[model samples]
Target: MEEKTYKIMSGSGIMNVIMGISAIALGAIAGVMLIYSGVKLLSNRQGITF
Candidate 1:
């Protein structure tokens, strides 16, 4: 019983760590994309007219 509990807890901890890393990677990618888009818009601002 204790062994099973320890296995389950270890699995859960590993999954949580994996998910945390993935979330951070996803957030970093999104942030980079946003910055790139902003830079593109600024660079092309002269071509846009109201």
Candidate 2:
């Protein structure tokens, strides 16, 4: 039996890594924005008057 191994240093592989990193960064940014907006909305809310 023979075993084969492959390396992932090719151009497409590197591009895939970059794309994955970008997706993660974008998701983080979106989450931060959502939290920030929620906080802002809560802070600016006026309570109901009786």
Best by TM-score: 1
Provide the overall lDDT of each model, using Cα atoms, as 2-decimal numbers: 1.00, 0.81
TM per prediction:
0.95, 0.72
lDDT of 1 by residue, 1-50 (tens): 99999999999999999999999999999999999999999999999999
Model 2 clash count equals 0
lDDT of 2: 0.81
Give Cα distance to truth, residue 44, candidate 2, Å: 1.0
Candidate 2 per-residue lDDT over residues 4-49, each given as its tens digit: 2234346668899999999999999999999999998798778634
Question: Candidate 2 clashing pairs?
Answer: none
